[model samples]
Target: MASPKRPIRIAGCSGAATDRRDAMRALAANCPNDPIDVIIGDWMSEANMTSRAASKTDNVGEAYEPTFLEALEPALPHIAKHGIKIAVNAGASDTELLHSVVTKMVASKGLKLKVAWISGDEVLPAVREAQKANASTFENIRTGEVLNSWKFEPIYAQAYLGGLGIASAFLRGADIVVCGRVSDASPVIGAAYWWHNWQRSNLDELANAFVAGHLIECSNYVCGGNFTGFKALETKGWENIGYPIAEISSSGGVVITKNKNSGGEVSVQTCSSQLLYEIQGPWYFNSDVTAILDELWFEQLSTDRVALRGVKSDLPPPTTKIGITAKGGYQAEMHWFLCGLDIDAKARMMETQIRLLLRPHAHRFTKLAFTKNGSAPDDPTNQNAATVDFRVFAQAPKEEDLMPQRFLRPCIDPIMQGYPGATPHLDWRQALPKPVYEYYVTLLPQADVQHKVHLASGETFAIPPPPQTKTYPAQQPCQAVTRGPADGGKWGRTVTGPLGWIVHARSGDKGSNCNVGFWVRHREEWDWLRTLLSVEKVQELLADEYAGKKIDRFELPNLHAVHFLLHDHLDRGVSCSSTYDFLGKNVAEFLRARHVQLPVRFLDRGRL
Candidate 1:
C-alpha cells in the first residue's frame, strides 16, 4: 500500500453488464506497476437481474451472470499474485452460487484467495405476502396501480442494497467480495469506506466517495467513451478505450485518471458528460448518501486527470428503490419501409390496410400500435432520408396470439398489393414474438430490508441501517424562468439554425423517465440557452414524445447545461417500452437537431 498521506488508487475495470467485452483481460494487461489497491467490476443491470431471476427458476445453480467468470478468467492469476483486492457486483441474483464457483476456481488454480458474498436484496416473499394481505405499501410510484391489480404476478423483486455489506466484507479481510443487486456505485463506496474507515455520519467525506463512485461506476464512461464531446478530444487509439481509475484520498478528494499508455482521453468535458448521464435533478440520491449537484464543479489538472469539488451531501432517503419484474405478455412487430414521395400517404395506407386486416382479431391483443418511424424526404440526399419505416406492434395475453409469422401474415402477405415502394428490412429471425418484462419501480423503507454479509469463514453479520430518515417529494422541479437573454451582443443580428449549432447534449434513462442535458461552451451562449430552452420550449422541441407528459427542467450554470426529465415518457421503462429508442439515448440528439433562432455572435464562432 502507498503512504497513508497518498490517495488510494482504485481502478474500475467493467461497467454494467460489459462482461462480453473481456474487461478482465483489459485490467490484467493494464494493471499499473505502482500497484492498485482495489479493483471493481459492475456486472448487474436491471435487465440482467430479471433474466437471472428467470434462470434461477429454471436451474438452481445458474443464477449469476456466467460471463462474469469468463471476464475474470484471464485476470485471476495476475490478481492473486499481486494480492490485489476485488469487490464486484457480478452476482446478479445468486451470490452464494457465485461464491461457490469462485472459491472452486481459486482452488483449482492452487491460489489462496478468500471470497465472500453478500445478500438480502431479494424481497419477493415479503412483497408477495404483503400483496396477498392487501397492503397499501406496494403501489406503483407513477401509475398508482396496486400490486394486486398487476396482470401477471411478479417473478422477482429486488431492493437496491447499500455498500455497508460490501464494506464489512472488505473490513473482515476478504480477498474477493461478490454481491447481488447492490447499486452500481456501491462497490466503489464500500471499498472507499473500508479503506478510509469512514463512519455512517461522515456525510461530507462519504459524499466525496459517492461522487468518485458515480464518476467511475461506468468504467470508461468517464474516460471519453460515450461522451458527446468525443470528437473534440484526442481520438487516437480510441478502439482500445482505457478504463477509469480514481485516486481517492482519506479526505475524500479524488483525481480520476486512466492508464497513461491507454487509448481514451479524460478531460473536464468527459467527466461532466458522465456526471449528467442518468441523474434526475440537482440532488442525486443513493442508498449511502444524497449528493447535491447544484454546485458541483470539475477542474482539469492534466490531460488524463480531472478533479471534482463543491458537491454537498445529505443523509440518504428513508427508502430505497426496488425493481419488480412481471410477465408482460408477448409482443411482436412487423416492419415495412415506404420509399420516395408521399411517404406519409404510403404509411397511412399501410396502417389502414393492416388495421383493417387485424380488426377481426383486435380483441385478442392488449395493445395494437401503428407507428411511422420517419418523415418524408427533405430534398433527398440519401436513400434513408426518402424512406420511412412503418411498423405495427401488438401485445397479447397468449403467446400464440403473437406467433410472429402467423400474427404478421396479414401485414406481410398484403404488402405488395397495399402500397408502392414498400419493403421489409428484417429477416425471419426478427419477425418472432418476444417476451416482455413489465418493470415496476417503487421504494421500500430501508429499515424493512435486511442486509447481511456472508464471510469466507462461513459466518454472517447484519449490516446497520442508514442513520437519517428523510422523505423526498414525489416530484420536484426547479422554478421556471419567464425572461429571455439580453438582446445586445456586439450589436449583431440573430440567425436561425439547428440547436446543435451552439449546443451539445447528453441524454439517458432513469426508470421510465428520460433526461436530456444540453450544454454550451461560451458564457454568452449559456445566457441565451437558459432563457431560450425553458420547459415549454423543450416540450416544443420534443413535441412528439413530450405529449401529455410532465417535464422538469434544471439549470447547471457551471457546466452551462440545461437538463429536463420527461416523466413516464419511456412507456414502462426500457424492457417493456415499444418505442424504437428504448433507452432515450437518441432523445438528446433528436432535440439538438431541432431548429432554433440564436444570436449571430455565438454562431459566427464556427464551434458547432
Candidate 2:
C-alpha cells in the first residue's frame, strides 16, 4: 500500500485563531503543482486539551477550540477531490467523538470516506485499569512521591503512536487518519517516511522528514507573528494566519512554505525561531536516533519557501524517556479583594491592619498579597486608582472548606477598615475559593523504554535502533541546578532557597531553540532571594492557567530557569505523553514514587 518516493509537504499556520481545516484545504489546493500524498494538522496544546475534556464533560462544545472540526469540514471535500490523504491531531481530548462528528458530517452528504477513526493515548482509562488491577501508580522519575489525583488536570492526552499508525490506517485503504492526539512531529514524519517506505535503517532519512515537520510545527512563530525585526515588512497579516507546508523529499531535505498569497510574511528569522521550538537541545531524540540541529542551516528558497539541510545523526542515548501519568489532588482559586479609595493606600493599610488584626497568627495564611492589582514592577508610573487590586492564595482538599470562608474574610474589609477617599461598591466579596487537587506527573528518561511503529493492520514496523545518550547522575549535580561543567561556553546558573530580594532576568532569543532564563543578585549581596519559585511550581501555575487544556511540555532539567517548549507537544511514535491530560497517574509523579532522585541542587556561581 506504499506510494511514490517523492518528498511530503507540511505547514504551520500563522493566524491568531484560524481553523485547521481551512488551512489544510488551502494547503492541498495551493500545493505547488507537485504531487502531495499527505497532510498533517496539529490542533491541540496541553491546556487546550484539558479544556476540551472538561467541556465535553459539561456537554458544552462552545468552549473548546473548533479549528480541527471546522477545518475538517471543508478540508475533507477539497482533499477528496484529489485523493490526498491527511492525518491530523486536532480532535481535542475525545478522539472517538471527534471521529464520529467528522464521519456523520461527511456521511450526511452521502459521501463515504475510507476513514480510520482511532483512540487510546490519554491515560485516564489506563489509570482506571491500573487502579483496578492494583497496579503501581507509575511515578515521575524525578521526585519520589505518589501522585495526589485531585490536583491533576489534563493538558493533552495523545499517544506517541508512530507514523506507521497513520500510514497503516492509510494503507488499509483509509483516506483520512483521525487521531485523538499524537506526537507533534510524528504526523509529518509518518506521512513522509511511511509513503517512501523508509524503514528504521532509513532513520537518518526519516530525520530529514522530522526536521521539516519540526520547522512548521510552531504555526506562525516560524513565519512572522513573532518576527523581532518589527519594521521589515511589505505586509503582515495576524488575522488571516498562514499555515506552513513542507515540500519534503524522500532524501530528507525539504522546502518549507505556506499557502499561496497568504497573509503573513515568511523569512529566515521566523523559520529559525520555529526550528528551536520544543526540541531537545543536544538534538531532538527520536527512538534513540537524535536529529542533530546544532549545525543545521536554512536557505531562502523564495519569499515563502525555506530549505533545511545539514542535519546529522547522533549516537543514541541509553535512557528511554519514561512517560508516566499519576494522580494529584485538585486545586482552585478565587480573587477576593479588599479595595477602597486611595485603593493603593487602602491596600497597604489593610496589610498592616490585618497583620496586626491577626496579631501573630498572621503566618497561618498560606498566601496573601497586596499590590497594584498584580505582581511587582513597583512602577510609580503605573499609579492609577482603578488599576489597584489585592489577591489571596488559598487551598484545601475540599470545596466546603472554601465555602465557609467565602464570605468569612472578604466583606470584613469594607466594614472593619476605614479609608477617607473610599466610598462606592458595597460588594467586597465576590466568591470563595473552591478546592481541587493536583495531578503530579513526570517524564523519566531511562533505558528499555519501547517505542514501536504499529502498522495499519496491527503489524509492527520495525526500525533500526537509533543511538541514544545515557549518563549516570554524574555523582555531582545537574547543571540546570548546580553550575554546568565549564566547557568554556554552555554553562548555566540556578538560584534556590530564600533571599532578601528577587529579580527576574530572561535571555536567549525567545524564538531560539533554547530560551535561557536566570535570576540575578548584586555582586555585593549574599546569594539570597526574597522569594524563589521552584521551576515545577511555576509549571503548576502555568497548568492552572491552562486548566483543562492540552499544553506543551516544559523541560526544567536543562535550562537555568526551566525554559518552556512553546507548542509542538503532539505527534506520533514520539512518546505519546499523557502528562497534559487528567492523569490518575502522571509519569513525573510516577518516577518520584520509585524514590529516584534524578537531580536537584543549589546554583553554583563559580563561573560567574
Candidate 3:
C-alpha cells in the first residue's frame, strides 16, 4: 500500500522566530509540484522561550508564537489539497494553547486534519524537588552557580525533547503536530523515521536522516542565506530565496534541494557553512543520537544539489539539557556618539565621567558596563565614518533605580560637559530600562523524564525511554590536530588582508559561550590554517573581551574547518547581556574583518 519507489521529501518552511511569513506562503504554494510530504517550522529560541514563559501569567493562550498561525493561515488550503503533514515546535512553552488555537482555525476552515500535541518536556516540578534535595547538583552550565543558590527562584523549566515522541504522533495518523521545546532537528528526523518505520537501533539509517535533518534545520540558511560566500551566489537567484528541502530515500540517502522555481542556490559551500552553526566539538549530541561531525562529508551531485554522506551515529547520551529562567532584575542603556579625532581618548573620558557621576548611587545597581563600538577609520570620507557608538549599560536590582529619570538623567546631564566631540544619540527608548530574565542551562537525566504524544481523539501514546544511564564526561578538547611546519619552499610571497580574504566562517551563541567556525575553500591551505589559527591566535583576534579567557579549538578535517568556543563571552547569555551583539551573531564577521597574513597560494584560490 506504500509507494516504495519514491523518496520522501520534507520542506523546512521557517527557521527561527517570525521568519518571513511571505516565504512560508511561497513554500506552501510551490510544494504541490515538488510533492513535499512533510512541512516543519522552528519558531522558538532562548529569548522567545523566556518571553513565552512570562506571557502565560497574563493570559492562557498568549504564550505560543503568533507567527505560527499567521504562517499556516495562508498555507492551510494548499496543505489540505496536497495531503501534507505539518510539524512544528512553534508552541514555545505552551503546546496546549497552540493546539487549541490551531484546531479551531482548522475546524473553521472546514479542513479534516488530525492535530496532535506532544508534551511531557516540562520538568519544573522535578527540578524544584531536586533543588530542595541538593541544589548544588543543578549547577548552571554558564556560571557554575547552583539553581538554589541563584539570586531569584526559577519560574519555568523545560527539557529539550527528541524525535521519537514526534514520530509516534505521525504513526498515530496525526496530520498536524504542535510541540513544546523539542530539538531543532526533531521534526525532520521524526518525519523521516515515521515514513520509513525506522527502528530505534537503526543507527546507520537514522544517522543519515539525522544529517539531512540538520542540513535543513535552519530552512533558507542551507539555501545560500547567511552564507559567508554570498558573493558566489550574487548573480544567481538569491532575492526571495527558496527554503531548503531534503529528498531522503528509503535507504537513508539524502539529496538537498529547493523548490523548482524559487530563488537561492544549494551548493557545497552553502551546505558546509550551515553545518558549522552553534557547534562546539566533533561529537554532536542529540536526544536521539550522537552524530560524529568529523566523519561527515558532502558531495556536489549537481548545481543546487548536494548529497550529504559519511555521517556516523552512536547511542545518545543518557541525559537531555534543560533551560530554566529566573527574573534577573532590570537593565537600561544610553548611547553617545564619539566623532572625529581622538576617539579613544573621548571614549575613555566618557566612561570615567559616567562612572564618577554614578559613584554616589553605586550600590543601587548590580553591574555597570561601558562599551565603545566602531572607530574612526583613517582618512574618513564622511562624518558617519568617523563616529563611534559609545554606550553605558547598567543592570539594577530594583525598577526605581533602573527608571528613566534615575538612570538617564545622570548620563544625559553630563554629556554637554563631557569629552570633546561627544553627544547622546537621540533615541528615547535608550533611557527606559527593561526587565531582564536570566537563563540557566543544565542537564537532566533522560530516565527521570517522561515523553508522550497526545492526539485530538483524547488518546495518548508513550515513547520507550533510554536504554542505559551513563554520565557523559564534561566536554574536553580532542579533535584539534597538530600540524608540522608548512614547507616555505613551495609557497610564494605573502599578502596582507582581512582574514576572511582566505577563510569563511559562521558564528553563533550557546548559552554564555560563543562558537566561531572558520574554514578554507582549498584543501591545500588546511595545514597553514591549523598552525596559524590556534586557541591563542583566536583569542588575539577577539581582542580584550577574550583576553586571558578560556578559548577551546576543534578541527573538522572533513570540512577543512576549525571551530573555536569562547567561554563566558556573551555575558550571561542574551536576556541579561549588556553587549549590543547579545547573541554573538556578529562574532564571526568581526573576526573575519581582522587583518592576517596569508600565503599567495591560498589567497589566489579565493576571490581576494
Candidate 4:
C-alpha cells in the first residue's frame, strides 16, 4: 500500500491593495513551527481596477500596485533563504512593466531567483471589437443592459483568469510568479495544483482547494479580523492579528490555521464568517471550477486549527466575469452640523433652503442628495454628543459645474438664513470636485482571453480554456424551508433586543450588489433563525436601505446560515458610489443592530 503524502502549507499575506505592508515579512520570518511551502497574495478588486484605469487615462501614476514591491523587499531575503515560492496578482494592468521591475530588483540583490509573469487578462481591444460586431455580447450581467445603452465610454476592460497559467510558470522552473487581474483565489489554487501535480480532471480536489483559497484569500479575515466575536481575542490583543495558512493534503483535505503565538484565533466560528463573506449564493464560481457550498462543513480539529470537509465540484462555466471602467462624471460634497432638539425639522429646513438656492442650476447636476448621518440622543451629555451631520452631495458631468464657486457658493449661501445651531464644516477643500469612475461588470467568453505565461527560461506558451464546461441557471433553487417561525409557545419565553444578541453576520459588495450572510452558533438555533429571517423579514429590518431593491435569499443548512443579496444597492459600485457605506461592509452590522424578538432559550447560552 502507498503511504499518505505530506501536505503543502500555503501562507496568505495580503487581502487588498492597501493591506498591512509588513504582513509578508512577518509571515516569512515569524512562522517557525509552521514553515510554509509557498506564499500567495491577492491585490486586485473591481474598485481597484476602476481607480487604476482612471489613473492610466490621466497619465498620473503607475498602472500596477506599488505596495507589492514594498511588501516583497523586506521578505526577499527570507524567501530566498528558505526557497519558498511566491505567487501574486499585484500586476493590475501592466504586468510587463511590473515583471521588468521585479527582474531588475532580483538581479540588483545578487540573487539568482527566476521570476515569471502571466498576462492576457487585459481585454480592452477584444471588448471593443466585440462591441463593434455585436453590443449584446458584452451585456451587463446584473441588469441585462446592453453595452450600446451604456452612457459612459469604457477606457479599459479586463477578464478574470484562472490558475493554469500560474501552474505552468511554476512547472517551467520559476521561483516567483506575478499576474494581472486573475481571480483572487487563483494564486492559492495554482500553488496547490503545482505541488500535487494534479490533472484538470481532478474536480473534487480542485474544488477543495478552491474553497480553501476562498477562506484564506482575505488574510486575517479567517483569523478573527472581521469576526463578530472579536471581543474574545482581547487576551492576545489585535495589534498583531495573524494571517491565515492552509495545509492541503494530496487528496485535497484542508486544515486552516494561523501563525503560532500571534493575535486572533482560528475557530469554527471565525472560519465560517470568512466562508460566508461576499458570496452570491450556494454555487461559488471561479474560472477553474465551481464549488457547491451548501454541503460544505467546518470542524475544529485543535486549538487554532479548523478542518474543511464535504466540498463538491462541478465543471466551470464557459464564461468569466469581466470589469470595464469608464469616466462616470465628477462629484463634490459639504457637511453641516445640526445640534440639540428638533433634528428632523432642522434637516428638513436645511434641505429646503439648499434646494431653493440651487433650483436654477439643477439641470446641470446629474444627482443631488441631502443625507442625514445620525440622530441625536434625547438627553445628551455634551455639545458634541448632541450634534448630527447633514450632508449635501452633488454630481455633474462637467468639472466646472462642481467647482467651489458654482457648487459650494449656492450651498453656503443660506448659512445666515439657515436654522439656528447650523454649523458648516470649516474645511473648504471638502467641496472640491473629484473625478468619478464607474465599474461595469459583465460576462466575457473564456475563449476571448489570450491567457498566457512568460517563463524565466525565455519560453512562453498559451493556456487553453478548460477542457470541460457546464451551464448553470441564473438562480439556484433554495434548499431550506422558508415558512414562518413556529408558535411562540414552544420557545417558553422571548425577549426584545438586538438581533446580534444571538446571531453573527458578514457582509460585502459584489459590484453594485450587497450580500449579507447571517448565522447562529448552535444547531438548535438554526431552525428558528431560518424561519424567522425570511425575505420579508430582511426587507422589514433594512427598510431604509433596501426596501424596494430586488433581493435574493438562500440558505446553507450545513453552516446554519442564511444569505441575502440586494441588487443595485450600492448605487453603481465602490468607485462611483455616493453612499457613506460604499463598499457595503457595514450592511451586516446594520442588520445586526436592529431590535428583534429573540427566543430566551437561545439567549441563555450567551451573545456572540
The candidate scoring highest on lDDT is: 4
How do all models score by TM-score?
Answer: 0.94, 0.64, 0.96, 0.97
**Candidate 1 per-residue C-alpha lDDT over 400-469 given as tens digits, one digit per residue, 9 for 90 to 100:** 8877544777668776777887687666455577877777887777876878999889999998679775
What is candidate 1's local distance difference test score?
0.80
lDDT of 4: 0.87
Maximum-TM-score candidate: 4
Model 1 TM-score, 2 decimals? 0.94
Instruction: Kindly report which residue pairs in candidate 3 clash with one another.
Output: none
Which candidate model has the greater lDDT, 1 or 3?
3
- Which prediction has more favorable TM-score, 2 or 4? 4
Candidate 3 regions exceeding 4 Å error are: 1-5, 57-61, 468-470, 479-485
Clashing pairs in 4: none
Q: Number of clashing pairs, model 2?
A: 121
Model 3 TM-score (2 dp): 0.96
Instruction: Name the TM-score of candidate 4.
Output: 0.97
Model 4 lDDT per residue over 1-608, tens place:
11238788999999999899898887777646569888999888887788787776677789888889999988888788777889999998888888999989988898888999998888889898887888446778777687878898999998889898988888778889999999888988898888888888988988999999999999999999999998888886687789999998889999999977789999999999999899888888888999999888899999999999878999999889999999988999999999999998999999999898888877899999999998789899998899999999999998988888778988888999999977899896869999888888888878888999998777889999998899888766553347565555777789999999999999999888899999998877888888888888998899777649678888888889898888888888898888999989999999999998898988889887
Candidates in descending TM-score order: 4, 3, 1, 2
Distance from true position, residue 179, model 2, in Å? 1.4
Give the least accurate 10-residue stretch of model 4, judged by summed lDDT.
477-486
